[model samples]
Target chain A: MLFDNTDFDYEISFLKIPGSDFNKEIRDSKFLSPEEGFLRGNLMKDEYVPYKNLTYFKLTPQNEQETLLLKLMAYSFTINDLNLYLDLNPKDQQTYELFKKYVKEKNRLEEMYSEKYGPMTITETQGSNYNWIMDPWPWDNTGGSMYV
Target chain B: MFKYVKHLNYPINIKKKDLKMAKYLLTQFGGANGELAASLRYFSQKFSMPDEKGKSLLNDIATEELGHCEMICTMVHQLTENATIEELKAAGLGSMYTEHGKGIYPSDSFGNPFTVTYFAVTGDVLADLSEDMAAEQKARATYENLINMTDDQDVIGILLFLRQREIVHFNRFKELYDYYKKKGY
Candidate 1:
């Protein structure tokens, strides 16, 4: 819950960032490309695969599957990040366009990933068996098996 | 009614393990100003908020805080996962180790377990909304301190992202407050 309190620094800067013309302009401008930055990725580096003890899968450089998955994760995460920002900055055309573009890309990649490997989302599952969980867990960026 | 997504919102791929930093971050996870309380407070307050906008704002922000909680836990998990007993003691996680044994426990970095006493659910729309705005700020401040404390770029990047959400949430809560005030609520 690191965030439900009345923060001191937050009180000082609460309305300052959004209300300020300069800050808002910069935020809404295309100058800020949020693609690579702020995307969701584990800080675990090469360790920990959520619940399962690594079946001893040592941290290996991202395989081809991992690389593609990382890209997908980045684009999907960018959408989430921008969506929240857009809620506040509705008039930001650049942000809107970037968001739309990312949406397209994310959709394309999800479709591709689903076809090649497995569903990333519930809707992506082709068959009715709910076999989507058959693939690597989302946090398992290394695509290593817990039993390895 | 929430669908579980098997992932952290902002990622926590900490390359370096540091129990001290993890301990400090524990405050934001289960501490008074942490995400868990934020999520619970807002989610609970939604039922009491008068207007649709205020209700939705509380609902959405509260839900998002749950995601933040996952990320904070990830940080804590990785930070202490590989630490030895001695290292844990040095990082001041000794007491925590005694209690949870390197497992992620929803307590402040100081080993104070989570308690609902940190927040108020006064059922007053204005009062709750006002508190919501202040909660976002405190979160932002905590993120700032976290960023300043850590040298890891990965950690700092996630911190910055979380910090930005606090700003956005504050803005939205402020807007909801203004809207309700204008309506003579």
Candidate 2:
């Protein structure tokens, strides 16, 4: 086991807008699951264009750590894609609301992930220990190997 | 004003060591149509944008391009790890080893160091956005070529994701361009 406290559940779905039909603009905009959003590199289905019609192979997390990190990546990518859209279409109320929900969920996930897998950013560091310089930095093969 | 995030925008864990592929991938890192140039181009152009939309779009895309730059560097670092001197020479990376020695340098595949000349920042909003759109298309094409060079699934997945990002960026730049045009900016 990588850590003793590895019992956190990660079986939650993400990025679905409730009462989505009310907003005509949002109804036109399609969203992908956080996982698909991360894989496809765009949250908005309309914006994603696959190169050569080749679908990216799905990622399979090997462990709890991998699962948690993948979740974080998915959530982060979704938020980022929405951010770009919001920057251009700032008045889309439903989209903004969805963005807020994703943001809140991402924050919660970050906190949970930090406690289990060390701080991904300096701000997530807790107590007296500085785990920021921990081994397997993002460049290290092992650090980011979860995607493969 | 950037906070450090010790994670990749997309996760990349390449298990194979391919020096030749790394050499080709360098183009995306520092080539003429590379992420570094894209980042700097928008970052420089944002200040001259006419209004909030242009500024926000450029600034935000600039910030995102920095992340892409980091991703490219990380890919280079991992691809070149554990390479021996002979291996580097065999892969036509002897000159790279001579100077950077496995370190990630911002240079194109042809060993030309990164220069601002790779991109231009015209003060005119329409012109800058047009350049940005072209840059994204060029990046997309470059990624396609890179994908063709590699049979490694690990590398291909990343290239595909990045290629998709280029499409998104290009669309955003086009939308901004059209918006500015309609507003007579």
Candidate 3:
């Protein structure tokens, strides 16, 4: 039912990503400025959870430049987590060191940005033995949920 | 040096009456595109497999299919429970219903019954992998068709889950095929 012919264009737009062939034109175009490149990369990477309400700025950037940095830090956190938890071996010690270094940087950025807006509570529930209040799972809401 | 070995067994069984659905399930189970034939093909092909990973992949997938056979039998039993002799005959299950009267048995959907000819044990790895891939697609499609026919939510859920598993298994075999091809075996 969701695939009815009339909404095909709208549905197709939802599937576009930088790496996908559908966005080839965007991929080939050069950035107009450093700020543009940074913002474009962040949007393409899609590494941050979008706020539920557009007007709610809690832990979210008010401008494009801050949004780019927030996304960059979030992306770095994901890469570090995967390297620590899933990778077969830590071939480069520097990568692990970099992850540790970035963790601090991310915390600082989160704190600074959140000062202007209310803090974002990423976790919802904590149990005595197990914590279940985590970000929504991948299948729950796709990119709308936390990146991790 | 001896390597550590772990033995695994499928944790299910088929009963006499369960054959009604099994027969239907196996109709495409052993011909050029059937699951039984496909599984046997992969199992035997292990001997000529040049790499440990390839051999392990084929053997594991073939072993899993045996469990799927058991699953189909389980579904058959659940579906045909408590049917009267007359009721079964009326449903066109007379050949099997006459003998077993809702007893589980393995046969094609038409009640031709199962035979050893339903499986093949070809030793060629390439031939066997090709057969396994095709077999998975066929089985997945059959599950989809069966889901559409049944109004039972439980049955539909099971079929959908099984269909998804088949897709996953197909992807794994595809990756294994690519790895083998790259290794030139």
Candidate 4:
């Protein structure tokens, strides 16, 4: 369900809703009434809607390594999600095994990506001062698309 | 004020319909391992935190937990938007809707509401940090449980993001614990 640059704008529009309060709880308590609780649960599972325009990066020889590194990160997220889901629903033993397999594959790919481009660092080296790395932030395309 | 400090924010777009997930996610939101409980637990324990660094770490982690609460609520709202009564019932959300009627609220996946006892504000830094670390692991496990039940990639993606944060936060607390111990506090 990865939305490309064309659809990223559409998704951002929905994300810009103003004055919405999703964290409100019942009075003097964290529990919602049964009806309220159930309704809230259902709301959390809605489909993705595009809200903003997105810009796609052109793949270049210099960026090939960076691109693969980003892809590995996306894969890492997928594996993490699949692993968590398997824990919630153990009834699907086969799916669980598949998720485990994918996790291993993702790990292998991540290792390859790292070897090719060097590890993604939280810190960057300049002439002297070691500064925290920035860019490809969470909201950026490098965070990867929600739809994949 | 580090120039490169990352400003933590909820990363996804939440819709009106996602409230149901908010309710269920609230189980963790205010439940034993939920952010509300985790925040209070850390904040309360900060009083006895041995050093300035330890106290600062506790404050930072507790504040981050608040953001996690916001993120979960955003997911809940997005999932429950423009939902019908029939749709809500089918999703096992009838109980919560009876009271809030499409409003956002926090409760367990099973509809049991949040209780204060879900968190303890112990004043001991070691005891509190240890509890905080364990809480993060429990939350990671819970996220794993949530991920297993759903086939939705978006939902799974968000849960994965959250689970990773849990691991990161656990590591942060562990570091703080070690620092405190090394200082003999």
Q: Please provide, for model 1 over B1-185, each residue's C-alpha lDDT reduced to its tens digit, 9 standing for 90 to 100.
A: 77765445644466688778989999999998899999999989989888555665677678778988887887777667778999988877778888888678898867889999989999877888898899988987888878778777656766766776776677678878887788887
| Count of backbone collisions within predicted model 2 | 0
Predictions' DockQ, in order: 0.09, 0.44, 0.02, 0.03
Our model 3 lands, by Cα RMSD against the true structure, at: 15.7
Task: Show where candidate 1 strays beyond 4 Å.
Answer: A1-71, A78-105, A126-148
Report the lDDT tens digits of candidate 2 across residue range A1-148.
Answer: 1111122122322333355542344335587666666877776766766666576656777777787788788888888888888889999998899899889988988898889878888888664688888877777787654443
Candidate 3 residue runs with Cα over 4 Å from true position: A1-148, B1-35, B116-119
* Order of models, best TM-score first: 2, 1, 4, 3
Better of 2 and 3 by lDDT: 2
TM-score, model 2 to reference: 0.91
Candidate 2 local lDDT, residue B181:
94
Candidate 2 lDDT over B20-93, as tens digits, reads 99999998889999999999999999999988878888898898899999889888888899899999999999
Writing each residue's lDDT as its tens digit, candidate 1 over A1-148 gives: 1221122132232122344463454355543323223321221112112211111111222465554555565566667656655655668887698689779977887677677777766767666577767755633434422111
lDDT of 4 by residue, A1-148 (tens): 3335333231222112245332232223222221222211211122112212211221122255544443454444444333333333447776566557556765675556545433343342322433334343323323322212
In model 2 chain A, which range of ten residues has the least summed lDDT? A1-10
Name every residue pair that clashes in candidate 2: none
Q: Please name the candidate that would achieve the greatest DockQ relative to the true structure.
A: 2
* Candidate 3 accuracy as lDDT: 0.45
Candidate 3 chain A weakest ten by summed lDDT? A49-58
- Per-residue lDDT over A20-120 for candidate 3, one digit per residue giving the tens place of the 0 to 100 score: 44345434532111122121112212222221111111233446434634444444333323332213223556546544654665556545533433233
DockQ value of candidate 3: 0.02
Q: Which ten residues in a row have the lowest lDDT in candidate 3 chain B?
A: B4-13
Report, for every candidate in turn, its global Cα lDDT versus the true structure.
0.66, 0.82, 0.45, 0.53
lDDT tens per residue, model 4, B1-185: 22221222323533234444555675766566677777777777767776666666666666656666766665665577568889888877888789878665666777666676776667777777788889888987888777665556556656755665676567667867776677776
